[model samples]
Target: MYHVVIGVDDDVEHALACVQGVTNLPGDAAEKEVTLVHSFTDNPSGASATQIHSVREASEYLEDHGIDYDVNESSGDPAEVIIDFAEEEDADLIVTAGRKRSPAGKALFGSVTQSVILNTDRPVMVTGTARGSE
Candidate 1:
């Protein structure tokens, strides 16, 4: 089975887009497994809400397609948390939602998706936000 890790955050629409992209991937869907992951630096309640919402949405889609999956939540930097979880899970692929950010904004605040892609050895799949959606 293929182990796929999907990173999620407070943005439900973006998270759903990630899930949708993975589900629609061209391959043997029945042989793939999904894991929805969310991270928060603090506030367990807020973290829980975000993770739950993302997981619920993803689960609805997975269940409809009879895909096996699980949910994970962590308290730390989002990029680090997601990468660590994927490593621990021995994920074959890491999927994440991308947000529209200007070069200055990305340079100033840094980007979780960029960090994950740069750090991980595994393949990364990013989906969400059309080029002009911002």
Candidate 2:
């Protein structure tokens, strides 16, 4: 019974693809538990309501597959929230989308996937989409 945790962002297609890949993995389909996580930074400027709805939509996608999972939402730096949630849930695998970014974008914004890879002791699975696919 592996605990698979999928991190969802604003990209719905990428998120759905990531979930599909995980569910298709051997033994994953039989697992009774999974987790869908979405994290948002608490910027005073506010965040999109659509982003919150995206998380719910992701959870619904899992349900449609007859897979059981817990849906989570949090406010903070994305990387921190993801790492903390995985640890709290004792996840066996953490899955997320991988997007290539310019060196400047990486340096200034910092990638949550990169941070999670560095910080977590647990195994991480990243699904990459084609450039400009989203």
Winning candidate number (lDDT): 1
Model 2: weakest 10-residue lDDT segment is 42-51
Compared with the true structure, all predictions reach lDDT values of 0.81, 0.76
TM-score of 1: 0.87
Please provide, for model 1 over 10-90, each residue's C-alpha lDDT reduced to its tens digit, 9 standing for 90 to 100.
776877787777777777678889988877667835546334665677777777777788878777899998899999989
Per-residue lDDT for 12-69 in model 2, tens only?
7667776776767776455747777777765465755334655766666677877788
Model 2 ranges with Cα > 4 A deviation: 43-51, 130-134
* TM per prediction: 0.87, 0.82
| Per-candidate RMSD, Å | 3.5, 3.6
